[model samples]
Target: MTLPLEEDSRPPYLQAAEVLRTEILVGDLAPGSRLPSARLLQARFGVSSSTVQNALRVL
Candidate 1:
């Protein structure tokens, strides 16, 4: 899978966080929604497990 965010100055974690945050804000990912697994996020965003953790923590 490809990250929705790409080619920006922000770090990968921050980028991923923003993407997820946007989804939440727009109701695409509703409140109390279960996020994708860290492994899935890592695969989707091409980032490390720690990066996915950090992104999830941002929410």
Candidate 2:
């Protein structure tokens, strides 16, 4: 089986930030709720910690 692979349309940091921000805006993820740690985001996004932080910085 061939699994589909795709490249990110936006920057990694931007994508990560938007995901969390959207969750916050939609109430899917509430404020003051413990967010996934940098390590977690790092693993999830497969990006560097700085990249995850850049996204969070947007919030």
Best by TM-score: 1
TM-score computed on alpha carbons, candidate 1: 0.82
lDDT of 2 at 17: 79
Model 1, which residues run further than 4 Å from truth? 4-6
Tell me how far the alpha carbon of residue 20 in candidate 2 is from the true structure, in angstroms, after superposition. 0.6
Give the number of the best model, judged by lDDT. 1
lDDT per residue as tens, model 2, 22-51? 878999888779888988878877778898
TM-scores, one per candidate: 0.82, 0.74
What are the runs in model 2 whose C-alpha is more than 4 Å off? 1-7
Return the lDDT, model 1, position 56: 86
lDDT of 1 by residue, 1-59 (tens): 55645568787788899888988899998899798899888888888899899888887
